[model samples]
Target chain A: MPDTPKRTVFYVSDGTGITAETLGHSLLAQFPEFDYDEVRAPFIDAPEKASDLVERIERVKRRTGLRPIVFSTLVQPAVVAVLHRAEAHIVDLFGTFLGPLERELGMPSTHAVGRFHGILDNRSYQRRIEAINFALSHDDGIIQDGTLDDANIILIGVSRSGKTPTSLYLAMQYAVKAANYPLIPEDFERKALPAPLKLHRAKLFGLTIAPERLAQIRQERRPNSVYASLENCRKEVEEALALMRREGIPWIDSTTKSIEEIAAVIMQHLQKMQKYADL
Target chain B: MPDTPKRTVFYVSDGTGITAETLGHSLLAQFPEFDYDEVRAPFIDAPEKASDLVERIERVKRRTGLRPIVFSTLVQPAVVAVLHRAEAHIVDLFGTFLGPLERELGMPSTHAVGRFHGILDNRSYQRRIEAINFALSHDDGIIQDGTLDDANIILIGVSRSGKTPTSLYLAMQYAVKAANYPLIPEDFERKALPAPLKLHRAKLFGLTIAPERLAQIRQERRPNSVYASLENCRKEVEEALALMRREGIPWIDSTTKSIEEIAAVIMQHLQKMQKYADL
Candidate 1:
C-alpha cells in the first residue's frame, strides 16, 4: 500500500474562526484514515490579511506538492474574493448557506463580520459570566447557603468521576448553573444523600465511571494510596451506582464518554423533566 | 413598518450538534433584525431519531406558517435522507463540504459518526482534563509552589476583569493550561509586579475592563461597597493599565469582548511569540 497522503487544511474566518474550525474538524473526522496538518487563520477581516493567508496557503502547497484545503466562514465579500485566489479547494461555509437563507427569509444577510461570538447582548453575556462564576464557587461540594437553590442542576459522583469539567462545560456553553458534589466514602457508609442535596433531589444527576478507569485516574492524583486502589474504586463505584438507583436519580457512565457527550445527555434529561413538569 | 418575522431553527446532528449549532448561530447573527426560536437535535445517529426530528420540525412549520430552517451535520446517509424529508430549508453541512474534500483528497469518506468531539485518543483527552484541573486549581491567584511554572499562559487583571472564565475557556476549548492572578490594590501601591509573576513575565497577559463596566460587575458581587464604587474601579483600572504598560505586558480591554474573542487574541499573541522565538 502507498503511504498516506498528507494535506494542509486551514480554517479561516473574519472572526475567531472557532465555528469554522469546529465544523471543519467534524467534516474531517469522516476521513479518519487520512493525515492532515491543521492551521487556524482567525481574524482575517481585512483584504490584506486575506492576501497574507493566501500566500501562506500557496507556500504550503508549493512545499508539499499538493493543493491545500481551506474552510472559510468569511462574511466580507472583498476578503472572500481575496481568499478565493489561493491555489486550494475553498469550502465557503457562509456563502453556501446564506443565499438559501436569504431567499427563505426574503431578506439579504447583513454580511457582518464577527457578530456571533461577540458581546452581542449584555444580559446574555452577563448571564454566561455569572454562570461560570457560579460553577467555580460551587465546584467540588463547595456550597454556600442558598447557593444550590439557584443551580439548574447538581451533579453527584465520586471523585475523579468527571464532575468539575462537565459542570464547567454546561455553564460555559449553555449558561446553565451547574454545581457538583463529590460522593465520598462517608456518604457510602451513611447510605444517605448529602444534607444539601436531599432538598434538591429533583435537580440531581449522577455520574459514574468504571472502577478500572477511576483507579487509573486516581493513581495520577495520588499514587499508591487507598484512593487509587482498584478495590476501593470498585467499592465506591458500586455503592454510588446502587445509591443512585435506590434514589431514582438519573445517572450516566462517564468512563468512555467525552465531556460534550456527557453534557448533552444531561441536558436531554433536563429537557425531558421539563416536558413532564409541563404535563 | 412590519413586525419581524418569527421562525424556528433546528440544529441537527448525529453527534453533539455543537458544531452545527455554533455555525448556525453565526449564520443567524447576520439577520439580527429577525426573531428566531432555536432548538438542538443532538445524537440523531439513527434513521428513527431522524424521523422523529422531522416530525418535530414539520409541527413547528405548521404552527408558524413558515418553513423551519435546519442546520445539520448528520453523517449517516440514511439519517440525512430522513432529515431531508422535513418541510424545512436544510443546510446539510456535511454533504456540502465532504464531497469537495473527498474529491480533493481522492478518497472516499468513511462516514463515521461522532468522531470529532469524542475521546478519540486517550492522551489528548487526558491532556484536556488535566488542563481543566490546572485552571481550576490556579484560579483567582490560588497558586502552589512551582505550579505557575507549568502554565501555558498566565492572565493578570483586576477582580472581575474576565480572567477566570477566559482561563477556563482556553483550557476547555484548546487544552491550554491557563493560570490567572488578580492584580490587587497592593500591587498598585507597590508599583511593581508581584514576585511570583516576575519570574514568569514572558507568559503574563493582562485584561482590563472599562471602569464603568468594572463597577457594574463589582456591584453584582458586593453592592454598596468601596470595591463596587465607581471611583475605586476607575483608580484600579488606571493603575492596572499603567503597571501592565510599564511591564511591557500585552493586554486587552475585556469590556466589550467575549471570552472566545479574548482567548483567541491571547492565543494569537502566544503564536506570534513562538514564531519570533523560533527565529
Candidate 2:
C-alpha cells in the first residue's frame, strides 16, 4: 500500500476549542487512511486574531502543498469571514447548527462566542466541581469503610486496567460521582468480593484488559518487576473476570478502549439501571 | 419577565453521546433565555434502541405540545432512519460531516461507529493518561523540593478559586502537565510570593475570585468559620491579586469563569509563550 499523504488540520475556536476539536476528530476519524498533523488555535475572538490564524493556515498550505482544513466554532460572522478568506477548507460549526436552532426556537441566536463554557454560577458547573471533589477524595479505595453510599458508580479493576482515568473522565465530563478500587492480590487470594464493596454490588462496574497489553502498561510503571510480568497480568485479569461473572457485575475489556469509551459504557449502564428502577 | 417555556432536548449517540451533547450545548447555550431539560441517550446502536428514543421524544412532545429537539451522532443508516421517523427536529452530526469528508478524501468512510474515541493505542491517548497521572501526583503543590521542574504550567490561587478543577481539565483535555498551588494564609501574611513558587515564576498563572462568591463557596464546606468569612476571603483575594500584579505574572478572575474557559485561556497563553520561544 502506498503511504497516505499527511494533511494539516486545525481546531479554531473563540472559547475552549474543545467542541471544535471533538467534532473535527469525529469527522477526521472516519477517514483514518489519511495521516493528520493537528493543531489547536483557541481563543480566536477578534478579527485580527482570525487574520493571524489565516496567515498560519496559509503558511502550512504553502509548505505542505495541500489545502489545510480548518474546523472553527467562531460565532462572530466577521471573524468567520476572515478565516474563510484563507485558502483552506473551513467547517464552521456554529454556522452549521445555530441557523436551524434559531428557526426552531422562533428567535435569533445571541451569536455569543464563548457562552457554552462560561460562568461557574451555573448549576452544571457546580455539579461538575462537586463530582470532581468526590472522585479525588474517594479515589483508589481510600474511603473509610461503609462510606461508599454516596458514589454513583464504583469501578473495580486490576491495577493499570484504566479504572482511575475512566473514573476521572466520567466525573469531569458527566458530573458522575465515580469511585475506583484496585483488585489487589489479597482480593484474588480471598476469591470473594472485598468487604467494603460487598454491600454496594449494585453500583459496581468491572474493567478487564488483555494480559499482553496490561503487561506493557504495567511495564511502563514498574520495569523488570513481577507486577509487569505477563503471567501475573494474566492471572489477575482471569481472576477479576471470574469474580465479576460470579457476582453478576457488568464488565468491559479496557485493553483496546479509551477512557472516554469506558466511561461512556459505564454511564449507559447506569442510565439503563436508573430507567429500570424508575419503571 | 414572563415564564419562558421549557423545551426538551436529547443528545442521542451510538457511542458516548459526548459529541452530541457538546455541540448541542453550544447551540442551546445561545438561547439561554429559554429553559431546557436535557437528556442523554448513549449507545443507541440498534434500530430498536432508536425506536425507543423516538418513543421517548414523542412522549415529551405530547406532554408539552412542543416537538422535542434531538441531536444525534449515530453512524448507522438503519438506526438513523428509525430516528428520522420521530416527530422532532434531528441534528445528525455524523450525517452532516461524513459526506463532505468522504468527498474531500476521495474515498468512502468506513462508517465505523465510535472510532473517534475507540482505543488507547494512539499517542494522544497515552499523553492524556500521562498528563492525568501528573496532575494527580502534583495536585495542591504536593511535589517535593526542586521537583516542580516537570510542570508545563503552574497555577497559583486562593483556595477554592477554581485552580484544581482547571488544572485537571487542562491535563485531561489537552495533555497539559498542570500543577496547582493554593495560596495559603501564610503567603498572604508574608505579602510575598511563596518561596517554592518564586523560582518558577515564569510558569506561574494566578486565579482570583470575587470575595463574596469565594465566601459563599467556602461557607458551604465550613459553615460559620473564620475561614469562610467574607473578610478573610476579601483579604486573601486582594493579597493574591496584588502579588500577581507586583510579580508581573498574568492572572484571571475566576469568579464567573468555568474550568473550560480558564483552561482555554491558560492554553492560549502557553501557545503564545511557545510561539515567542520559537521566534
Candidate 3:
C-alpha cells in the first residue's frame, strides 16, 4: 500500500452524491496504485456550501502538498463556479455528458437539480414501494404459504448467510419480488426439501457460506452457544449445500461476496433461465 | 413527449452493473426531453458474451434505424474490442479514465475486474453487515429499549410516509445505523413528542408527505377503510408537519422525493449540525 501515492478524493453532488461516487470510484479503482482518502459531500446546492467545500479541499492541499481530485455532479453553474477556487482537479460529470445529450435531443435541458431522485407519483415509484413492503412482510419465512406465489426470486440459505440484505436490495433497487427462507436443523435432519419450498423450486436460489466464517458471524450474535459452535456450523453448511445440489439449485458462496454481487448473479441466472424458457 | 427523439441506451458492466446504471441514469436525466428505453447488461466478462452484446446492439440498430448509446465499464481489452463491432456510440467509462490514472500513479494497474463490489474480510465489510443487522433489529420501534443509543439517525414519519425503505437504504448503502419511529395517533393527539424520542432529539429527522399522495398510498393497502380516506390522510399530514415544526426538527416531505433524496437531505443536515458542534 505504501508504494502508491496518497491523495484526497471528494465526490460532490447537488443531490445524493451517489452518481459522483460511482463514477469516481470506478475511475480510481482502475489505477489501483493510489491510496485515496475519499469523502462524500452531498447536497452542495448553494454557493455557500460550495465555498465551504472548496476551503476544505484547499486545507487538504496545503497539508498534503498534493492537489485533491473533485468529482462533481453539481448542476447549477453558480455553485459549480465556486468549487473552482479549490486547488484540485475537477472532473465535472454533468458538464461532460449534458451538452452532448442536449445536442442529440435538439432541445435545451431543464437544468433540473437532483432529478434522478425526485419522487414521482408514478407507477414505477408505487411498484418500488410495494416491492419493499412485500419483501419485509415475506422476510425470514414470514407468511410462507401464499407469499411465494408472487416472488420473482426466493433465496434459501442458512443463518447469517447474507439473505436478508440481498433480498431487500433486489426489492429496493430493481422492484424484484424477493423472499428468503432459512434452512434450519429440522430441514437438515429430514434429508429432504422443505414441503413449502418444493412448490417454488424454479424460483429458488441458494446461498452458502464457509463454515469458519459462518461460525465467526454466528458467534457475534450468540457467543459461546452451541448455535455458534464450529461443529454446528459445519454440519449446517454441509447439509445446506447438499440439499441445494440434490435439488439442482444454483448456489453461490456468500463468504466473500457483497450483497450487490450476490443479487447480480441471481439476476443473471434468472435472465438465462428466462431465455431458455423462451426457446 | 412524442416531440423528442427516441433512443435506446444500454448500461453494460463486467460486474453488478449498478455503477453503470447510476451514472448513466444521472446523465440521461439531464436530457428529460428525450424518451429513453434502457437495458442493463451485467456480468459480461467473456469475449463470447461481448460478441453476443454487439450482435444484440446491431439488431437494435437495424430495427430502429437509429444508433444505440452504450455506457460500458468493461475492463478487459479483448471483450471491449468485440463491442466495437456494434453500430453505436460507446461511452467507455473505464477506458476513458484508466490510462490517465495509471499515468498519474506511475504504476500499471492490476487490471482486476469487479473490485468495486467484491467483499473482503475487512472492517468496512463487517461494519456494513453490522449496520444492516442493527437497522433491521431496530426497525419500527421494535425492541425500543436501548436501541436508539446505537443509532446514528432516527427517522420519524407517519405511516406509509416512506420511513422504512429510507432507513434500510441508509444502512445498506452508507453503513449508517438508522432507525425509524412511526408517528402514531396517540402521539399526534397529545401534540407532543413521544417520550422516548425526546431523549434523542438531536438525532431525529422527520418525514411528511402530501395528503393526497398519502391517501392514495394508504388506499392501496386498505381500499375502503377510514384510515385510507382523504380526510384522514389530510389530518395526519397536517398534524405531522405541525409537530415537526414545534420540535424544531429538520423535516422534508417524502411525497415527491425518493428514498435517496430523503436520505441525502438528512445526511447533509447531520453534517451541518456536526460542524456547528465543532465550532
What TM-score would every model get versus the actual structure? 0.95, 0.87, 0.88
Docking class of 2: medium
lDDT of 1: 0.88
> Clashing residue pairs, candidate 1?
none
In candidate 2, stretches whose alpha carbon ends up further than 4 angstroms from where it belongs are: A1-7, A36-39, A46-66, A77-83, A118-121, A144-146, A275-279, B1-8, B33-39, B45-66, B76-87, B104-108, B119-121, B144-146, B188-199, B275-279
lDDT of 1 by residue, A1-279 (tens): 966556888989898888888878788878877777877888999999999999999999988888998889999999999999999988898889899889998998899999886545556776778888898889899996556889999999999999999999998888889999999989989999989899999999999999999999899889999999999999999999999999999999998899999998887887787732310
Best-performing candidate as measured by TM-score = 1
Worst 10 residues of 2 chain B by lDDT: B270-279
Chain A of model 1 scored by TM-score: 0.95
Regions of candidate 3 where Cα sits further than 4 Å from its true position = A1-6, A31-33, A46-56, A76-86, A100-110, A118-122, A275-279, B1-7, B102-108, B119-121, B144-146, B189-192, B275-279
After TM-score superposition, the amount by which residue B102's alpha carbon in candidate 3 deviates from its true location, in angstroms, is 4.1
lDDT of 2 by residue, B46-118 (tens): 9999999899999989888888999998998999999999999888888888888777767898778887776
DockQ scores for all the models shown? Answer: 0.60, 0.54, 0.53
Error of 2 at A84 (Å): 4.0
- Give the CA lDDT, 0 to 100, for residue A255 in model 2: 78
Tell me which of candidates 1 and 2 scores higher on DockQ: 1
Alpha-carbon DockQ of candidate 3: 0.53
TM-score-better candidate, 1 vs 3: 1
> TM-scores for chain A, candidates in order?
0.95, 0.88, 0.85
